[model samples]
Target: MRYFICALFFVVSAAHAQNTTALPEGAASPKATLKDISWMQGHWSGEAFGGITEEIWGPPSGGSMMFSFKLVSDGQVGFYELGHIRELDNTLVYELKHFHGDLKGWEEKDEVQSFKLVKVDGKRVYFEGFTFEKVSNDEINIYAQIGDEDGSAEEVTFNFKKE
Candidate 1:
């Protein structure tokens, strides 16, 4: 029994260690990062594609942030998306999953669209081909490059103002 307990302890510790690996050299710790984009948290609304678009962001917590987006037109929801901004493999990454208005998921349950953070500068955060630019105290412009089936890129832009 004692030997079994010791083996279990080592296994659990190894698993925990893998999940908490330190950031790479020159990488900012989570506590010291993402603060530059604090201006993004809040309820924002705007018009897009003939629809009313809404994005809600929560304050940073646990070295991560969460947000949700929804679009409604003619009193019907078009789609919904949930996103996470977190530290992974010593880098900031944005991951998103989409769902239809009826809550049918678009991606496989185990899959997500991952966007690696490229840089952050004075009121802007760039991730892979996407960007979040703060146009004003209460306004932001987001540009996203979604890949199409034929290996092409499609641009989607949003200009939102704080609600």
Candidate 2:
């Protein structure tokens, strides 16, 4: 009976191990590739609607990108945003979550926003847009409309340089 129990335990352990997926050999580690996004690695400060805004983006675990931003002014909080970026299925994908100061929790989150590289005016540019916001090489814009039930959007432009 003891032998049978031992054998059963071994079988179960082996089965569980086999179900685990492993990364392919020679594939770039996520951490290493995510570090490549270092181009956006910095602390940014800006102003919009009389509020002071700050944003930061950096490498995440397993070759992913992580970002967080917040806006505040006059001792009042405005908004906050967080996101992650990674290359999946041969395409760059981004997931984002946004929250308003008055809201109790995340107001919105989406993972379908994707980006692709394109050549514009002989220069490589990346573009990505979700339901209400769009980002390009030189600018990031949010669409704004009133009383649509979908919430208003705001667009902000950003330019990056190594410091």
Candidate number of the best lDDT: 1
Q: How close is each model in CA RMSD to the real structure? A: 13.9, 17.8
Candidate 1 lDDT, tens digit per residue, 1-163? 1111111121212222311122244654332265766778999999986789999988889877899999898899888888878766655777778777899877778878766566776677776556788999899988665443433434456899999
lDDT of 2 by residue, 1-163 (tens): 1111111121212122221122234543232233334345556555655667676777566657788867786888776767766656544454555566674334323322233311111122222222112233333332111111232222233333222
Please report how far candidate 1 places residue 112 from its true position, in Å: 1.2
Clashes of 2: 5
- List runs of model 1 lying over 4 Å from the truth: 1-32
**Clash number by candidate, in order:** 0, 5
Any runs in candidate 2 off by more than 4 Å, and if so which?
1-36, 106-125, 130-155, 159-163
Residue pairs in candidate 1 whose N, alpha carbon or C atoms collide under 3 angstroms: none
Q: Which ten residues in a row have the lowest lDDT in candidate 1?
A: 1-10
